[model samples]
Target: MSQENLELLGQSIAPGESRTVDFSMAKLYTTTKVEIPIIIERALEPGPTVLLTAGIHGDEINGVEIVRQLIARKMNKPKAGTVISIPILNIFGFLNAERAFPDGRDLNRSFPGTKTGSLASRVAYHFTKEILPKADYCMDFHTGGASRFNAAQVRIVAGDKQLLELAKVFQAPFTVYSGNIRKSFRSTCEKLGVPILLYEGGKSLESHKQIVKTGVDGVCRVLDSLGMLQDQFVKPPLTESGVLIEKSRWVRAQRSGLLHVKIKCNKLVQKGEFLATITDPYGTMRFKVLAPNDGYIINVNHAPIVHQGDAIFHISTQAGSI
Candidate 1:
């Protein structure tokens, strides 16, 4: 049997070879080309193709660091199959240190984009047409939104036995059956029969050392599980047993005030436990926040000042034993 060359972005990467491809999305105001950078590593043996994408939200730096370290450490030197990694998907957002595109559109919500549509739509359309069809599996890395912190976790579609197994192998501390959003990357992948795991950790824009380490280790583990890596990498130490969560709810602030958090993300809490306190400037008013159910905190807003009805804490309930 003969091995085949991997073709992507109008380039061919032969077996045992790796190449970086710069896919131009559009030109900037200064006419500089805006390209989505990707690294393709093709092994000598035949196997499945896996894709790793990050920076869809632009400010998610943990995933960016994870992909950087993965490439730097030569983790892409697989024993079989191919690894396609895109460290930054929204280059414009990343350059501006923002989460959305310059047109104020969320790239994550612009999947299956059209060529003549908005900037985000065009970029998404290009990736959907050119990159996604080559993948057997996918992993989209993310973090909590601006001013929010998320504990390292994997979000998968519910009732997917295959994806659940892969998520467990990834070994993130928490797993949420978070379902899918309309026109999202995951949704497009799902429609194309590509099973993808959405891994979230830390906060946006800032790289957390632990979160980055966890993401890197998780990617390696997934590769090893897929029989892609020749040398099996050592598994990172698990700080907490993996939990499968059935549902989660975000607790919102009732009144606008300065937030005084009494607990941090990933902390298990009992029902009625004091979670935080909202206070006015000058200490004139205070309101206590409490947990509504027994569960662990998966996400929290870190911003000191928040408006009424702002999400404060996300708690995972109905955790099923894995």
Candidate 2:
């Protein structure tokens, strides 16, 4: 059915009407069960249907926290339409704080999934079939997984002008324009004509104050844009504008040993600037890593030890306010 039909089915969603429902009637453990937790907030009027999702990669706790905060603050109240949240998708991986589910599948890669496929594929299929079709827009939150650290940034598919507008309104510290690869949540949503924003922040399984604050502020800004809530709650500074990054690259270690990174994430650097260096056990040999171009640090390797060719930093450069 078209989105217009869905909106027609329900109108003027009000207090006490907002409810949480387990879309998956059975737990993942059950042979015939699929578990998808959803929070539905129905406002008192007709408006756009927005979806906020996280934990596609079970280990990405920051996204989960973002969704939790959005829901807990009652950010969906008095909305013109519906704001749905699926805070956790990969239950098994989340339980263990691992990046992928138990079957060793990347949920994000298994979009538009099949029922008879692997665990991750099954979850992805369920999401596309059950959730994506209902929403007008989407925001999928993420963070660097276990091995790396990422600065807070919003990644919008390059060709999505409408989504880009919504993303800028989010007023995140960094907005990176990335071309979507096939099978990603962003790509799938795009194919369905559902504009989606991908928010990346901090590192996996760790908490950063700025990331959390920005996340809360980002969602509120979007809600304000969507007319879900009043404008007074929005953070004006973040809403002022954001830097736009066209392309990004990772600087890898040339030698294996201990690493000393001089620049933290979110710092601006010039081309050929010293980013980090690798030193041997006795410091007899040192490999200096330099920036290939002028850009800002979006992801930094937090691990002290590394091997040759391991990505140490991700930098992006683009003209205009970020």
Candidate 3:
């Protein structure tokens, strides 16, 4: 039998249907309404409901691009299940080109919020209560905060074999073991028993082609594993099951100066490998930043200049091929 009609935001959409629901909340100072577009697609056959979301950080344009491509290419139209894509969750921050809500709160850190909380908290409360409960599986996209460009990877809390297997199926370049932060979306998903794979790539405000492709391809692999990918798309080939980073640490700059990086994000480096150089703008003194240990360069700082203690590189302390 076909799946029951999906209900969201007080609207009912039956099987083999497509709908776009506008989630409206607080308006701008000018009283203009801002709506978050939630696109839903369902198949004739019954299967799992997968939720795809991006732009939670607002400045993470690469994540936004990834979801946008999935919709534009018709990838969200599943074969046997339902797909709901929310390309930009924090429309307020996206509109202002800021990282946090207008009230200066990170929407991600305000999950399961109070009914009368701040604007960000209210958005979180409604989403956690209304929308999140309907999802069988969830995928959230993100990027490095500012100048740090992260390698394409799926992050999951360690020790969950189910989530680990799902990450393997997504097949990003790396599978990172990260603990869920309190009040964060990943933690909320865990609390609600919804499996989530959090993807991080590139950096905020910049959309890289390769990073977007990796994200889109990873989504395809995950959907195909669940038997939800459309027939028009081919299943992605399996590569390395993806490297597992058990532990990681940042390589910090020892001196403040103009920075020049020499290695790519996913490259493996030796302990003493020359990774980058921090030099005085006037060419007086220079300091070489070497790898702290032998591991993959999973994140690189793309800033033109750095402070004495700024993190310049994220190197894996312990990693093994899965």
Candidate 4:
């Protein structure tokens, strides 16, 4: 590829070249400049360009670690296509160890934003304008929000054959056909004709070694499937074929109290099975939490204290449930 044909941030990268670009964003209160870090790897041959982004919700660290390890291991040295790695997309939130930007807006929900919009919106605007247009396939990595632990899973929009095939190739133990949320990055990308996958695992602000490994391996597998990586670089099978889930629901707390969860993520539960118990501080009052249907536990809230109607467990029902 000629330098003129490959450009990002007004810079050209020839084939078989790799470069790191820092795109400037808003400044900190202390006048420190914050930039989004991007690593671009252009292969010697022409193929699809795959974009891998993590830390959109800053506290989700598993994807950050996965991207770090991926870059360290030279996984970006694709044999046939380009790999754009944005390890941390929300610098402000990352710095503060929070989920949203410093302005308290969710970056993931600020897609297709305006230039004169909020901080999150401006960041999203730049990403949408500069980075996303280059992607043929995209994967956004994430973890469960605060106090929740999720089993490794890939979420895709339903009825997209190409995305479903790619999700199957990822083999993340669970593939959720989730509906689109307005302004979400995935929805915006879909509207722009880019096939995107969202990988969720572990929990915010903490690294689960196994989950990180799974993410790294799954990424390589997807690249291999896309012909971006060489066969030799493809990962060994880390899991059996993932279950494609069409329906899921969160089991909520019945009453406010201290919660004791009896089940773990990835475990199968029968209908009406014992899942948890809520007890008062004095243990004078107790309420049993039971599975609403036969399904697999995909996520669990780790917080001991719960309020009435709080989501406690995320269950992916069997195919029949749909």
Candidate 5:
């Protein structure tokens, strides 16, 4: 039963049968009627069900574009097992070019949602009840929010050894071992024993062609590892000494001014290295920003303007590697 053979009522797909499930809106002029477009492709052979989702945070454009390209490419050559893709989960935010919903709610933070709470909560509820339970593995795409820039990396939540192994197959430049944050989609999914890998790259409001290629390649590599795709399509590289950071800290600005940063994100920095300088009007006074420790810059604010106490940089030191 290939997906093409699936009835309008949604039937079980036979091995190698690829199909698209209409999660689209049933009505107009209402968020309640909007559908979360899903493409569920089941292979001819039985394999693990992996869910690839993007636009959890609507402002992140790289992941959204990557998912789009992936689906366009994958549809031509069907993979073995089932792959459920949600390319644009936050349609409202994506349409508005915003990070949150129209109600100013973050869908990622409202996971395993309530039916009666808020719009985001209700949407989250739909995902929890409809898609996640059917998945054996998950890959959630993300990127730096607006005003922030991040290097390509995969995040495996603490205690998820199996997810870490799958992330290893992705072979992203950086592998960050992160802990679960309360109410996060990963945290809620963890409660259900669903291991997930979080991949972050590029930045909001912009797109990187190379990063997009890497992301698509990485997703294919994971599917290959899970036996969903042909094994020889992509040969994943070995990550060279990925940093397993337990925690990261954001460096805050001391004053409001125009920020001139000297270092780049994802670069290794020595202790006391000049990171940036904040210049006031007339350039009379400048506050120098220095590295707090010897570590790598995982993320940094790209916007030149900043307020006092605003996070300007995010750094993490490898355990005992510093």
Candidate 6:
């Protein structure tokens, strides 16, 4: 169960060896080393390598929990290839319990970065240069920003038959067609020819049990398909692929007031159905929000107050079966 000369980030890793590599790039203001621990597990038989990551946005605790559960359950110990789990990629952001880097930059937006760039960009630079090249596929966990709660879903760009197939295999609740942002990690992975499946679930700063379970189960299914899943773990039964969301739009609050949601996320609603109510502080004014069309409610705003133009829900305008 050992292969010779498997080098990663200038360190030699023998096959079947489990190692935790502390990636040190910079130091804090107190001169403390900022180390990002990368947990790796390799199998004796050579096959594809999969990289699993979370915490690009520090406040998205559900994503972090999903990756944590995978490691705690020993799911990363692959049977054929290697599994690399970086549970907290943005250590700086995580320490502060903030979404962005200490410098106010979103780490997810810094990709294929430069050595002399901002802190986030520099971290991205080293990761892109040293670690990402080894991954044949990648799964990056994420969640809805702030108080927006998203249904467990996998986001993939349109027209890539291969990635779409993998998304189906993962079997999250939904598979959404989304365009990659410029300079985002998903974009960089595409440029490097590495297929990536981005998962979104729950809301920031919270860990939902159902979300974590969905994510962990999806990863197992993907590994099993790749022949990397271990024999000890029971292979998960294939479920219907996530509902393919071809097009979706945000349903904004029509008036500024204290909002009350009447339905939960992932619920199917008919057109003109009551979704929420907005009321004024004086108790003199009330406004009812209705579904614009028949679609699934994929996201919901958990915040109690909303402005006139704030987005309160994400409804799929078009959906199809795989």
Q: Output the worst ten-in-a-row residue range by lDDT, candidate 6.
A: 1-10
Q: State the lDDT of candidate 1 residue by residue for 1-322, as single tens digits.
A: 2358877889988988979999998898999988888999888898889899999998899989888898888887778899899999999999999999999999999998898999999999989999999999999899999889999999998989999999888888889988799999999999999999999999987999998888888888888888886675564555556888889998999989999999978899999999999999987999999999999899989999999999999998789755
TM-score of each: 0.97, 0.90, 0.98, 0.96, 0.90, 0.97
The residue pairs that clash in candidate 2, if any, are: 12-44, 13-43, 47-80, 113-125, 242-321, 242-322, 243-321, 243-322
Ranked by lDDT from best down, the candidates are 3, 6, 1, 4, 2, 5
Tens-place lDDT per residue, model 6, 1-322, is: 1345457877988788999999898899999999999999999898888999999999999889988998999999998889999999999989999999998999899998899999999999999999999889999999999999999999999999999999989999899999999999999999999999999999999989999999999999999999999889887787765589999999999899999999999998999999999999999989999999999999999999999999999999999876
Q: Which of 2 and 6 is the better model by TM-score?
A: 6
* Tens digit of per-residue lDDT, candidate 2, span 3-120: 2323211333243366666655335455866556677776656778888988888778888888887777777553477788888877778888888878888878888778899877
Against the unseen true structure, what C-alpha lDDT does each candidate score? 0.89, 0.78, 0.93, 0.88, 0.78, 0.93
- Whole-model lDDT, model 5: 0.78
What lDDT does candidate 4 reach at residue 19? 91
Q: How accurate is candidate 2 locally (lDDT)?
A: 0.78
Predicted candidate 3: what Cα RMSD to the true structure?
A: 1.2
CA shift of 315, model 5, Å: 0.9
lDDT of 4 by residue, 220-242 (tens): 88888877776557575755557
Off by over 4 Å in 1: 237-240
